[model samples]
Target: MKLENYNVIGVMSGTSLDGVDLAHIQFRIKDKKWDFTILESETIPYDLTWVQTLKTAVDFSQIELEKLNQEYTSLLASIISDFITRHKIENLDAICSHGHTILHQPHNGFTLQIGNLPEIADLVQQTVVCDFRVQDVQLGGQGAPLVPIGDRILFPEYDYCMNLGGFSNVSFEENGTRIAFDISPVNTVLNFYANQFGFDYDDKGQISASGEINEALFNELNNLDFYQQNYPKSLGFEFVKETVLPIIESFEIDITDKMRTFTEHVALQIAQALPNKNGRLLITGGGAYNDFLIERIQFHLPSIQIIIPDNKILEFKEAIIFALLGVLKLRGEINVLSSVTGAETDHSSGNIYQPK
Candidate 1:
């Protein structure tokens, strides 16, 4: 039977490797419409060893990846258990996890998200809904930017919803269909150079602001093939490792200069993607805190209103949305939109496991 209300835990680990986000959410159907509240949220940072393992997970052989998957599943279960115990959360209808994405090559017909093992349900002693992308990919979609469904339902007032996590992606309604696509690499590229400076991140884009943009590098980056591609497209770490990083590295410049140039590239690309008119662009994720980057984006799109939500919404929106996806799945409602991901059809997509 479909539930009128649900208490769920949403989990997410982005490509930026910031940490695992956990959100205790209460979702309910009020007056025939869905509503939600984030009761609590936290981010659990990965230790150095786990960081290294996830960073190179794509290079692992099948057997190695399988082993790593098991390890990650165990680790994730422990994290979820701790969150529940610490919060004294009870009567959870489900735990919805956007398992850490290790490989996402939709065009090559495969995507792997670890920490989605069925045993997670048994370990956490809760019903689990996870591995949401595989089915969408099987339906011939990009299988990304799934959060847009949440955007449509949760923040219907906004004209655009953009996330600046590992990459920058934007979603909006166009011609009555929800359209979304990745604009450019964000933290994935920024944090890489930040690591060279022995920092996990640039700390509010200060490093980039300290440097100057390289016009030549900016031109080259803005001309990348991905930028020219139409909507319903998405980015993966492989694209960054193979296409983006090499271009940035080939430039003989200081890390700061690269950061500045890339930041400009990001701002320009985002501006170019947006419609040149008045509309609210709701920005979220780690990059929202990057004052310099946000300023640049604002500078480029002066007419459009940019809205950065509160800290919780900024950081945990993706996790919160994943929880909503699970709720929709539980209701047998469509969670994956073909208009956003180029799927064959809109469908509910996820693997559900009952506690053993």
Candidate 2:
């Protein structure tokens, strides 16, 4: 049966390794429209043990990855259980999880999001909806930027929805269809450099602002082949490991200079990725807090206005959207867009597991 109202928990762990984000969300459908309110949300930072394991899981053999997946699923269940107990959250209809992205090379006809084991449903004793991207990839799509469906439905006012997470991805309506793609790397690269300086991140982009841009590095970064690709594309950590890191490490420049140049690259790429329209771009995720990066993006595209929402939305928007995706999947409505992902067709995607 189609549910008109649902109380669900949404979970997301981005590639930036920021840790697991969990949101207790309530979704309702009325007058042929859907709406959501985030009741509670929290982020559980991964310990060094899990972090090291996840960061290197891609290098593991198939058997090793399988073992890691089981371990991750156990960790996720415990986290969700703790959240529920701590918040006294009850009546949860489902748990919608994006899991951690370990390998995402969809062009090779496979993408893996661990912690999605079916045992999650049994462990949590709640219906679970997850593994949303595989079907789209199977149908010849990038199997990414799935959040655009939520953008089109929940936050339709903005001309573009830009998420600045591990990477930056933008979604906008063009010629009556929603077009979205990964713009460039952001906090993933920034934080990696920041870690070298004994900081978790370049707080408020201060490190980046304190340095001068290397025109040479900036030019080379702007010339990366990914920038020339058309839409219906996505990025994974593999690209950063193979392409971005090598290019950045090749420079003998100071850490500050590298930060400044890479920050400039991010801002320039984002400015260029946006449609040349005169409207607001709703920016969210961790990068929205980077004042220096935002300044450069604004400097590059003075015509387009950038808007950031409250902290809850900023930190948990993706989690909230994953909740909405699960709701759509339960209703058997289209949640994945072929127009955005280049799939064979628009379809509702996600596995539904009922606890015994």
Candidate 3:
């Protein structure tokens, strides 16, 4: 059946290890366009144990990773189930989850998002749509920034949609086709140093604003090979661990100085990444809350109009988009775009598992 309406719980865990984000979203087709209401949403912050586990899972042995996958999937199931029960949700068609990306190297011909096992369906007592990235990589795509398709449909008003999460990515239409790619790391790098200071994050960029930028480090960051690479490229935590961290750590600067420099680096890179042409840019994700970062971005791109949405849309936008992706998959519509992810073709990408 081609249903015109869907009520689904969109779940997500990001590279920054913030927590599981659950959103009960109601999506409807109105006049051949997509409309959505965020019925309810909350970010369930992870405890230290889980945070530590996910932090180091990228380097786990194959067998160890396999075990961790099941473990994490079980946690995901419980989290989703708890969200539904707590919210008294009764009209769910499915649970759409992004799972957590432990390893996202599409160039290496593989990518893995843990907590996407089929068992989650039965455990949560609902149909499941998940593991949305693997198939795209197999098709020779970057298998990332998958939210662009959602941006094209749900946020057609904006000329560009930029997410400032673990990694920053921007999506926009060019010559009638949608284009998007990762520009740089945001919370992923900031949170790492923040943790060293016994803080989960730099609240409102306070710690960073208190320090100074290291010019040499900032210059090297600006000239990195990744920034020179053309579109159809994406980043993962591995990039921070392998390439970015080593370079940053090689300097003997204070942690606060590193944070300050990186924050400045992020602002400049984002401004440089966008086209010189003017347009309304929608900024979301945790980074949008960093006032210092936004100020720097505004300083760099003085003419661009930046939109910071309400808290619901800002935090739950990705979750809502994943829900839309699940609905598209259910309707057999193309949820992954060739222009955005560099896939061979635009196609429906996700695995649907019926509950046992």
What lDDT score goes with residue 150 in model 3?
Answer: 95
User: Clashing pairs in model 1?
Assistant: none
Residue-level lDDT of model 2, residues 264-355, one tens digit each, is: 99998988888675689899998999999999989988898889999999999999999999988988899999999999999999999999
lDDT for position 171 in model 3: 93
Instruction: Show model 2 residue runs off by greater than 4 Å.
Output: none
Residue 294, model 1: Cα distance from true site in angstroms: 0.2
Q: What is the RMSD, in Å, between candidate 2 and the native fold over all Cα? A: 0.9
Per-residue lDDT of 1-356 in model 3, one digit per residue for the tens? Answer: 58888999999999878999999999999778989999889999999999999989889999999999999999999999999999899978999999999998898889999999999999999999999999899998999989999999999999989999999999999899999999998998999999999999899999999889999999999999999999988999999999898999999999989999999999999998898647899999999999999999998989999999999999989999999999999999999998988989998999999998
C-alpha lDDT of residue 31 in model 3: 78
Clashing pairs in 3: none
* Alpha-carbon TM-score of each model against the true structure: 0.98, 0.98, 0.99
Question: Candidate 1 — number of clashing residue pairs?
Answer: 0
Name the 10 consecutive residues with the lowest summed lDDT in model 2.
270-279
Which residue ranges in model 3 land beyond 4 Å of their true spot? none
Better of 1 and 3 by lDDT: 1
- Against the hidden true structure, what lDDT does model 2 obtain? 0.92
**Model 3 error, position 212 (Å):** 1.4
lDDT assessment of candidate 1: 0.93
Cα misplacement distance, residue 95 of candidate 3 (Å): 0.6
- TM-score, prediction 2: 0.98
Error of 3 at 318 (Å): 0.4
